[model samples]
Target: ENFFDFCIHSSGESEIKIKLFFISWHPLIVPIDEIYANETGTLTVCRFYTKGSLKDYIHQTKPTNSAYWKRYGRKSLSRVCDLNQIKNFGRQILEALNFIYDNGLVYGHLHSGNILFDLDQALPIKLLVGFVYNLYF
Candidate 1:
């Protein structure tokens, strides 16, 4: 069975309540199932989406110092930088962070890699979505 499904099945009333509270207010943040490690352990498993992250896209488009000018010519890359896109990215990230902090949870592993980008064809531009946990941290 899925880890989240298993969590929902096994979680106590308090755990369910907290999960519901977080989900209700922050629809963008997907909560994974809370798994217990063994009969008594601090570790838990939380599975998240496999969507492509912002770092992936940024890396794809990153230009070498020389390629920077070669691709767009002598003109600075700033000329091609879309202000609206940058603003939207910042706004969404801030909103996500604010929501997490408001819940008294610290999002320690924040980075472009953690920010998933929605690349659905219907959307006008890329949209930064939720993040997955970094176990290394």
Candidate 2:
């Protein structure tokens, strides 16, 4: 249910289109479904996914033109969280970083937008969603 607005170049020539899908296993990555570059290039696009850079999480106010609209009230994602939830999310992020480091890879980008929450389940699940800035050893 996500669409990436970026494209990749193959052999520094043709542009490659990539499609990714969210998998249920890990909360820090996804899998690329397909890849093609103007019918050329040798770089094989494997089953790869992107991880996000978690910066911060907070209830943000939606812009409503002026103070009049703001006086009414603001809406937010109705996910009530506790200390345990925050702790769990922290642990998950650490685990993901550990895995990346173990593989001699480093996360180049880290920000709040990179982190995702799967609210479909009873307990919202955290997910990392960007990797274009990752560095592999």
Candidate 3:
């Protein structure tokens, strides 16, 4: 259903690979949400975006020549959107970026996959430059 539901209903999720996923704040940036963890690790949760990531929203197919082809995989999907929707998305992006920069904070990891269409609360700052561009490039 929704990202929140997905995270909560993940059954038995237990991992803490991404550090940022645990502690984050700000309206534009995905916030560190609810959960419990122990010595094993944290329940890393990224909200389920109905709109998906910006890359997912735009690209019809995975990048064939991309080094991350293995990760993105090869798939054909259809996108449904209009110019006005695109414009609104752009505005929201700018607002998010401004918020990050204004706070003297940097989005260490910036990429299409790093950006989700629904920017309410889920996912945030991360590592790996290649993993950065690699995630959704």
Candidate 4:
């Protein structure tokens, strides 16, 4: 449930958006400026700016079938997906996995909660978060 959240900018100058993640592996996370660990607390928190997560793209829609009804129960937060979208999503995920594999790292956490996306740019990109287990090649 604990994931990246945008940080509030207190500076008067134009500030870049920042995100915070707790107890994360440095390699798996996106490029970060700093990693601060609190010695007084048992949990470790990491602060960095990320494009954002796939959760931003989620939108509520009416269910169209029994399967959707069962899965979503009337109203669904899952947006209407087309074949191209599904294919693109699959390709993005595959590319992410390939990148990890090429870097001699294997990601064991593959789930919706771990999948993050950047849809604001001209060409949207997806990333996998929550590196609970990673194996080196």
Candidate 5:
């Protein structure tokens, strides 16, 4: 079965000041694999996680579990998680947040949607993408 493999997440405010931060690698931060630009703004490319974002995981599985991706996608990629799994996820989120703060940066946007789960791993499974990444300040 086919899954949602790619998508372009758009933001209105184009901050050209962002630079330098994308070069380094961090376990909790989603690495900028490539960046595409246009007249309006620029968009960064990262892996399309099989399990998708944490927001999708929660919203899709709860209640009736009717979402197409949840229902028809490969069951192996997603699982019936346990309490300890949740606690582990929480710990990773904190680690990501700590990394941001330690670098003297503030992540203004923090939410479930900003966090992603990569059931198919190249790196750690959980990662943060949405951060106030204006590094050229």
Candidate 6:
């Protein structure tokens, strides 16, 4: 709950935005009112998202189930995807980290599951980047 609360308030400031921009270029890092909670301290109201984490997308690939690759099989899907896409993903992650580090904050937990896919957009990566940007910055 504390983490979620921190994320909510953290995403609301301009300073946080600058910090986020420096850390991760990825927009998914932006915080959202995806999840909400009631706390016991002075800050009783909190908001966050329960939708899911990025790790879900990264770990989608499974040895037995090649179908998972359709979503995020980094290697096996190379035939259809170019190196640029892969590089972009990596860059986005680094940007996110940079934002966290620049602000003296630590993501603490990171994985493919934490990364999420935005199905509504033509480019999911762009959408996620925007989402994260709005949330934290």
Task: Report lDDT (CA) for all predictions.
Answer: 0.45, 0.39, 0.45, 0.42, 0.54, 0.44
**Tens digit of per-residue lDDT, candidate 5, span 42-100:** 45667666566776675554323466666545762444668977787888778877676
Highest TM-score among the candidates is held by which one?
Answer: 5
Where is model 4 poorest over a 10-residue stretch in terms of lDDT?
Answer: 4-13
Q: Which ten residues in a row have the lowest lDDT in candidate 3?
A: 128-137
TM-score of every candidate? 0.48, 0.42, 0.44, 0.48, 0.54, 0.40
Q: How many collisions between residues are there in candidate 2?
A: 7
Give lDDT tens digits, candidate 4, residues 17-107: 1122321233334443343322221222234325444443453322222363454454545676689977877777777667655543345
Mind giving the per-residue lDDT tens digits that candidate 2 earns over 1-137? 11122222221223222222222234454334443443222232434222212221243322232352342235433234589877977777677666655543344455555555443444343444334322323
Clashes of each: 0, 7, 1, 0, 0, 31
Selected candidate, larger lDDT, 2 vs 6:
6
| Rank order (by lDDT, best first) | 5, 1, 3, 6, 4, 2
Off by over 4 Å in 5: 1-24, 35-43, 61-81, 120-124, 133-137
Model 4, residue 76: distance off in Å is 4.5
Model 4 superposed RMSD (Cα) = 11.6
- Candidate 4 segments exceeding 4 Å error: 1-29, 35-52, 59-76, 132-137
- Per-residue lDDT of 83-117 in model 6, one digit per residue for the tens? 88668666766765666555665565465555554
Best by lDDT: 5
lDDT, candidate 3, residue 72?
Answer: 54
Q: After superposition, how far is residue 15 of candidate 4 from its true place, in Å?
A: 32
For model 6, what is the alpha-carbon lDDT of residue 42?
A: 18
Stretches > 4 Å off in candidate 6: 1-26, 34-81, 119-137
How many clashing pairs in candidate 4? 0
